[model samples]
Target: MTDKLNFYFETAKSAKIGIWEINLESSQVFWNAVTRDIHEVPHYFIPSLEKGFSFYLEGENRTRIKRLTEKTISNGIPFNDKFQIITAKGNVKHVENIGQIVYKNEKPYKLIGTLQDITKEQNLIIELQLSVEKFSSIFSSANDAIFIIDTSNGLITDCNPRSSELTGYDNNELIGLHNSKLFPVELRTELRLFLKYNLNRNEYTLNETCIKTKSKDIIPVEIASGKKFEVDNITYLVCYIRDISERKNVEAKLNLLSLAASETTDTIVIANEKGEAVWANQAYLDLTGLNMEEVIGHKPGYLSKGPETDLNASLLMSKAIKNKESINITILNYSKNGEKYWFEVNITTVFDSKNNFVNFVGVGRNVTQRIEKEFALKSLLDVTNSQNNKLFNFTHIVSHNIRSHSSNLSMVVDVIENTDDINEKLSYFDLFKEGTEKLSESIEYLNEIITIQQKTNIEKTKIHLKSEIEKTRMALSLSIKESNILITDTIPDNLIVTVIPAYLDSILLNLFTNAIKYKSPERNATLEIGYEIIDNYTVINFRDNGIGLDLKKNKHKLFGMYKTFHGNEDAKGIGLFITKNQLEAMNGKIEVESEVGYGSNFKIYLNEK
Candidate 1:
């Protein structure tokens, strides 16, 4: 019996297993050399039952050993368990301990068990479970089906629930099967060959293939294979399979919509959220005479911005889109040939699922024809209204002036009819002749006013400002010398303006004639005519030092027909009225400034270009 025990203990020592014994009532303990080595004590060291129990860790491990020891000593109950122990040098070790009560005269006397070092196996188990749990979390949570495959044999080692659900197979039926079962027979060969090639590359390989379900329905799928990895001495290939049927459907619908957009007559533009164009349809390209290269990555108005582009309108559209609001506006854009056209564009802001701006879709239609029609109608209406008002004023003035002369002649004829002396009758004849002459003169003046108002067509040419004024001054040289008028022309020598030739001559003649007619009774009359440029516009300032009118009271009637201020015989009040109308016909305006007794200044603004 001792020899057999020695053989078993020698074998146990070679395996790094420890053995122990406890004697009841004797209160003694025995540990083999193998056990002493596990506890980090000397080979010849001996221990009592108390010292043997102390090798166990405190708390649970020690208490468990004590309970087993007491049961064996009193009741002969046996216990087998694996637990922890602290070495003599304070090292934590995982070990298995088993104990059985030995019978001596039918009463329990000894308890023994084997303690083996299981630290390496236990730690490997923990590490394996941790890796599986981490990978399982990703596998199950992912939307796409994920599979773990043995790269060498092309066998499915593990797969997520999504893979089973997608293939209509349960976990029991899917594991240990070949991955090629998911594809058709013809594609299985291709897939297997593809795996062979990609495994050597050690990177992902993506391919579009068909996957077969349990019902034999072939569904399109996007298959991607990851590089091989080894865990626990087992090599695995991670594969991703994504069903692409929904994505293909979405793309098909988008292609149809794109075709529709191109076929429509209205101009269409699709752009990213930043207002940079990504796509422009056929109409937009044709309207601007631009190709894709000229339009893409550029703003909508960038191609059309010129001297006439409405910056305010473009700015408003930008602000509206930034705030995620749609805007509709009329924009004027120029084509490649420099011809201008108008389009009424409606832009809508698009948002994604998270309510973030994604794109701006704009649709525009050519409205140049409608705009031209409306402009023509507005011009006709304005011309008709002006003509009607002019006729009303002409009729009233003509009737009043002509009726006065006719009434005076009628009264003179009445005196002649009742007179008895030839001398009185003869006196009435001179009066009759004078009244007819006055009526004839008024008729001629009315004809002249009508002629001035009848002018509609204005052909303007560039004329030197200083030269025109000098010509008029020379024509009125006699009147200027008689009135002692000081004519000063401060206009620049190079100043030129576009004006109707006849109107420019007439305006200058009226200005000078008025200066001579309205000379201040208090001082020698002075007149200044000069030109200045402002905002690229030629401004002609006609300043006169003369008897200025009470503008506060007479301003309303200053340019009225036949209105006079100085009551001079030559002040027909027609020159200023003609001057004002002529300025308007030429797209110019006249502004006057003066005090009651100070001089008057007339400022005329005209286009410089």
Candidate 2:
């Protein structure tokens, strides 16, 4: 019996099992070498029953151990359980406890128990349980369908909840189903062959194919071959299937839009948010006479703007883009071949579903022909209106001037016929001669006016404006000297005008003569000539300090035929009228600002672009 007890003690010690005993009457604890090592205590350490219980973890562990110990001591009952305890080194360890009461003379005398450290085993078990729970949670909530297939027969061993939702099949129906059944008939054989290939390889393989649902609907899907794994000595493969039906639908729509944009006649250009051109359709390339290489990475219409393009329209488009707004503008654009065309472009801001600014889409329509026709119509209307005004002026001349001449002649002839003296009759002949001369002069003026109106198609030439003004001033040198007038020419040396040469000369002479003729007697006369560039026009301003007219009272008739001001006998009023017509014939216009007794300024606008 002593040898057997020693053998058992050696076996328990080798197995790292501990033995402990508590004397009930003495309240003392005895710990074997293995039990002392389990608590990380020295072999010489002595312990009491209370001190032994103190090593248990607080709360539930200590309370349960106390309860089990009291019951065993009172009824001599055996106890077996697991508990946690804090070792002497402050390490928490899991332990198994088995205790029984040793009876002496039918009364409980001592409590004996075995203690074994199970920390590593308990941690491994807990890790496995957590891993299984995590896998279950992910499988249930995944977006893509996951299938576990048995590599031997290509049969689906298991599927996730998403698999059931994707295939319209319950978990029971999906289990044990052949993996090929998930694909349509047309792709089933292909899937089988692909799976067979995947079994031999550990890497993933992806294929785009169609799958069949329970209702026979075919759905586009992308199947990714996952890594092969083994369970219970059987090899299995995981397949991740993702539905691509929406993606395929979006691709189809994009292709359709691309085709339409490429084939349409209207120019279409798509620009990035930075206002740089990213893409342009075939029509845009053709319209601009540019290749894609020249267009990409440049702003839309940047290479197409010419001197004739409306700056206002260009600015408006830029402003709209900066503000991320939409705008429509018709602007002149030039092609690569230097040909000009009008383009009506509608640019819209594009945004994503999140309302973020994406880009700009510009649709440009060629409106050159329509714009040209409109300009021609406007020119024709201007000509018609001008001719009608001339007709009205002629009617006034015939009714007012010619009728007065004829009446004078008739009255003089009547008086001469009623006269008895020969000298009186001879005097009437003098009056008759004067009347005929005046009528002939009036007819000559009418002919000159008609000729000016008829010369609208005369070719225009570019002439230095200052040089022309100097020449006109020299021609009127004597008049300027006689009137004591001062002339200041502030027009730039490079200032030039496009007009009929003869018309410009005539206009300059008239302006100089008028300034000299209308000099203010109160002060020495002064004239200031300057030029300004406004938009597409060059405005030549002739400002004079002279005896100005009451423009408020006579502004309406200022340029009318035979309308005279200042009561000067030689005013004729025809000079200004003829000057206006000459300017109009050359596609120019004149405006005047004058105040009574102060001065007059005339601004002539010329097409100098």
User: Residue 30 CA error for candidate 2 (Å)?
Assistant: 7.4
Q: Which RMSD does model 1 reach against the true structure?
A: 6.3
Residue pairs in candidate 2 whose N, alpha carbon or C atoms collide under 3 angstroms: none
Where model 1 places Cα greater than 4 Å from the true spot, the runs are 1-23, 26-80, 84-95, 100-120, 126-192, 195-204, 211-218, 225-241, 258-315, 330-345, 353-357, 362-443, 492-495, 535-537, 604-609
lDDT per residue, candidate 1, 1-609, as tens digits? 999998999998899888888776676788888788778898778888778779898999999989886776667667777678889899888777778887788777677777777878878888999999987798887878888899878888888888887888887788898999999998998888788877888799899999999999888899999988999888888899999989988889999999999999999998887788999999999998888999999887677766787889989998986776899999788887788998799999888899888889999998999989999999989988987888888898788989998999899989999989999899789889999998898888788667666775556789888888888988999998999989897787787798887877887888788878887889988998877777856888888888887888998888776799877876777788878777766767677887767889878777544
Over 1-609, each residue of candidate 2 has an lDDT whose tens digit, in order, gives: 999989988999999999898988887888899999889988899987787889999999999999999998887789999999998999899999999998899888889989999999999999999999999998878899999999888789889999998899999999999988888788988888888788888889999999999878899999998889988899999999999999999999999999999999999999988788999999999999999988889988888889888899989998999898999889999999999999999999999999999999999989999999999999899889979988897888878998998899899989998989998899789899999988888788888888999888888889888889888888888888888899998888887788898988888888888888898999989999988888888888999999997888999999887888888888877888898899888778899999988999999888764
Residue 439: error of model 2 in Å? 3.7
List TM-scores for all candidates, in order.
0.72, 0.70
- Report lDDT per candidate: 0.84, 0.90
Q: Whose TM-score is greatest here? A: 1
* Residue 134 in model 1: lDDT: 86
